[model samples]
Target: MTRGTGRGGSSAAARSVDVARLAGVSQKTVSRVFNDEPYVSSDVRRRVLEAAGQLGYRRNNAARALASGRTRSIGVVTLGTALYGPASLLMGVERIVRDTGYALRVVNTMEGDAAGVAGAVGSLLDQGVDGIVISEPIDEAGDGVDAPLRVDVPVLVIGAPSPVTAPTVLTAGDGADLMARAATEHLLALGHATVHHLAGPQGWYAARDRLEGWRATLTAHGRDVPPVVTGDWSAASGYRAGRELAADPDVTAVFAANDDMAIGLIRALAEAGRRVPQDVSVVGFDDVPVAAYVTPPLTTVRQLFDAVAQEGLKRLVHTIENPDADPLPSSGPPVDLVIRASTAPPPSRTTPARGRRPASPSPADTPRPPLTNGGPAGDH
Candidate 1:
């Protein structure tokens, strides 16, 4: 066997030939084993792997790609934020891509416009990605945006419903429609006369879906739909909305678009002398890690990000392998409503005294007690 003469005269970078010689098998067998191609006997595959490990042999992906005319890498275009939803989706995609023996290249686009998406896609194509995943497409109107949809490779868009030039997958089930209904219904069932919404910023598909769901549910139940208080998915925005809602003695139940805003709302309500669950019940979407640890563990809608990622990755891979296959619309995993200390029945009275502490409820009229700290009620 020939030894590599580069750097300290150490032959640590062994080639497939070296593994083949050591295992008494052909180099093609070693290649097949490393590539995970079928038709090689199990015993031979084991021998090749063991020999490669012993010889410190690594497969040359560059050479393989050159021969195959394809790069085993996928590109991901995502927003440039550390927010939980986008971050979780990226992590999920990364896990699946790594497991499937493909490397992931991520590009963060600050803008959510057509030019921004086009630039990101152009960069990925320049880098020779086999396929692309638009992890989060920004469609503020609930209606799909006309961003550059022209791509030669298979593309999977996460969280887009319309303008289906390519296969799309939503990270949350039924967009925000399912979650809003679940949260609104929960509060209504708890005997709240009406539910108010702390909505995400206008133009966000999520915000639009959630607002529509809330309005639809309220209308369906023959209740009046209150005006939405808009937020930028920030705690500060939620606090501002909370202050506005707190001033109105009639606001008893509030569903914030996300947990961050819900936390802010809680703080604002507390400052305004309105006790959560006792005076005004609050619900949030996205059961983030801190949801359960908050003072009054949050009642929220849980989105299965990992499951959505898995399904999206599966479809993208299938498309990449079978380019001629017809594209199909994909739905995301179901959402669950997690009840905690943050939500309860409305106070017995119609309206509380504005800017004054609400009266304590009598024992018989008390709503269900808050769950124990750090313990969440079972998923609905």
Candidate 2:
């Protein structure tokens, strides 16, 4: 037999004709199955799919786009870093986009500021994507020179709401302010007179939101808000901030913006001979995979990234299909606070005199009960 005449072979490449012939159906039926058009019976759809698989048939996306006058693809712009938040958001977008039978093209800003973001979006436009999603746009350099992105295509932003005219979606339900408030209040509820914050870098919208949340909670409760120590969302930065906090005897409780920084802060406290939940307590944001398995399980706020991605994708697709309809801003997904072993009431005694070391707490003084699953001890 000739090469093209074999059981699953074709003259050139497998096409709808081959699928239809092998499945004993008309070419139109095969087309309906591939296009997901209604009216194809279940048995015929299953037969067409099975035959396509057997014949190694792949849909001609380019041809479909040309005929339909639409590119079934989306462009995603995000930060270059592999930080958990950005990475997770990208994964979620990819999954949802694929489920909806669209292709995803991604561009990274390579740690640049607003200019980099503008460039990334421009590149996606050149590639002819149906829609664009900007994940975690940062204003690090703070040079307001970059103009707002102007695009004819639908645009969705995944970070904090911006001045850009595009409809924005927050990945977290409560935004940073509420999350920070929740974390700080958790520490205060444990009887810590005040809460110190180790914030994320200034450029990140997430960082700023968290700081705002922490400050607002402190102010509302009439608690002292210490000077903010900023970190690049890295454990090393947290360690550095922790070392400085370790020196101050007045430091009783700390809230790091992410779990990596929290881990670093805990290590620094340990090195300085301060026991967690004894001499000091630490809480972190982002309940990362290792948060629960750490030496002292982290008390953290968990944002539902998958839910955010799904909701954002749904909204973007709706906008793409109904261009004339007004796009409603989404409030995003809510966050949960998971109370673990890493926090407790402040030391029983007042802050020791500046230079004098505080007495170590006895076992009785540090009563660490089993960690609670998902609620704060009380309203701050």
Candidate 3:
């Protein structure tokens, strides 16, 4: 359907004369298919393929591939950096691509620039890649994307499409809303009247969505949404933001953008005489590898990075191979709040200043099963 038609809603129909002529068979013999000739055998099919190749004639794959099936190989474009989010996503994509028996062709953006991105994407198309998955940071470099090379191919733009240009796989907007609501709800469940957020840079969509989530949750719960502190997606920024909040004794709970910042918040809170769950409880997002290993594990939200990447890849290739297909929908698995030692009821609110130490979630709280390979993932 993507094949635009000309006047009278008609495009020039392809003729079989070329196919028969190239197959070196009579036009009548080729016509036998329309007549259901039972005599045609395997050898004849071979001749048809040879002739089609020689004549540069192709059966309308739209109708024919229904029988032959698509080829392997999917193209993907992502940030060149080995960041946690992208790295985790690639892990899932690699497993999926292998499981699907499709080869992966990855093109990293050179210098994390827009031109590099455009060039990588174009290279994938030139190879006739069935589909393309883009994992660039929209806040970092995706917002200004000027529509992928050409719109004729199916493209599943990850993290939402720019305006109404093409199909997309998104984990922002509503996804962020859910994340915020869930995070705030957990803190509220722990008895905090309000939650303060140390947000990632405003340019990032995650930062904005997280902020919205925090605000919306606070509004819903009739709690105050404090002014958000901005960070550079670094632990240093988290430390700085933590110091600011630590100066205020009334601030009992904080939600950082990701695990790295959460780590920094820990240092600041300790220096401020706050004993983690015992003083100011903290929750973080992304639940990175180190989250659980910290002195006191952080209670955080786990973004289903694998699911996001898989869905993005699936949508991109589908749209690329089937341009006329309806647009892909926004999809993401729900975020799970991994309760750990980092969060607890507020100190001033729940504990009399004379308690020895706060209680902790025992093995029952983090009953992670063993991984098949016997790794930390399986160990509690």
Candidate 4:
């Protein structure tokens, strides 16, 4: 046995046969003992164990994993898009996995379809994975897709909007609600007549939450709640919605469902000769990478999506590893309003639509309630 740093902090010299000589055994016997191969007598095994302990020997895990089928690895299935949220989450998970003596194998599954995800998991199981992770939120698809709720081993669901019934982690709520409330509240704070919304697809969880927030806020403030104008989560749809809203001339403050729609809204407003922050104020959600880089630098809700993703991953991993452990407490991320060059007071010429009964504000508008561990996706 020898101990000291050498090249790359290895042995100070080549392993000497002194331990074998001291233990009164052949060097091959010493090697077999280290390998834990059978057939060595109990006495010789005891002698070899003592000698190795004195030598300060450390078994190399990488070499051992190579020889043994156990890799202590977890497989992660992700949406291949590498969008902001998913991409950021991967970084966070890697940071933790690096030190845990566990390996992570990433498999890209497109849009988290049931088949794609299941196949990815199947591949990992074939590779002798100890556990698996699914990083799809079932976003805006409104639980429209199918997926496995259980697996033979642990299955962690990350990037989910609510805590999944099976072991999982997720963002606080549908998130769109917070964003909608913030955007509308910001406008109300500015003393706009009422805030109008250009919504995303109805099936999307985000779209539904945002609309709910808008309605709840309006109904609480003694304001009229107008019907939501639909969008396909695209700039074009928002542009179309904007054109119609612009026709009214009273759509003073508008909250588009996301930044991309906000861009379209701005373009439509400008096309109609309406000036931003002067004629119409628009607020958007997500504050995507391009939000600030746009022409006027959008005023939007700034969500810690990457942080959300990272936290969700952590929670899912914990739940997967120890399902019986106490549930984690949420840090409760705040949704902030970014006051940029885009939002301002309403135009003087704006007029209210006639004959609509005004709505009274509710608790969802002011002192808004937080999403309280809304149990997992599909529970609804």
Cα-based TM-score, every candidate: 0.81, 0.81, 0.69, 0.65
Ranked candidates, highest lDDT first = 2, 1, 3, 4
**Residue pairs that clash (backbone atoms under 3 angstroms), model 2:** 173-333, 173-334
RMSD in order of candidates: 5.4, 5.9, 11.7, 11.6
RMSD of 2: 5.9
Better of 3 and 4 by TM-score: 3
Would you list the C-alpha lDDT of every candidate in the order shown? Answer: 0.78, 0.79, 0.67, 0.67
* Model 1 accuracy (lDDT, Cα): 0.78
Could you tell me which 10 consecutive residues in candidate 4 have the lowest summed lDDT?
A: 371-380
Query: Candidate 4 residues 242-307, lDDT tens each?
Result: 889888877788988877788998899899987776778888887677777676778787666556
Q: Candidate 3 — which residues are off by over 4 angstroms?
A: 1-71, 110-116, 140-149, 162-174, 315-332, 353-380
Residue 90 error for model 1, in Å? Answer: 1.6
What's the residue-level lDDT of 114 in candidate 2? 48
Worst 10 residues of 2 by lDDT: 371-380
Choose 2 or 3, whichever is better by lDDT.
2
lDDT of 2 by residue, 1-380 (tens): 11134373435577889889999999999988987788999999999999888777878888889997779899998888889988887888899999877889999887755467778888998999988888854774575554566777777778655424454332323366777787887787667889999999887888888999999999999988789999999999999999999999999999899999999999999999988877888889878888887877778887678888888888888788667786647763465778876886787653467798867555464443232245433221
lDDT of candidate 3 over 1-86, digit per residue (tens): 22323235565443457657656787666655433356876677667656545544434534433453544567777767665766
**lDDT, residue 133, candidate 4:** 64
Provide the lDDT at 121 for model 4. 72
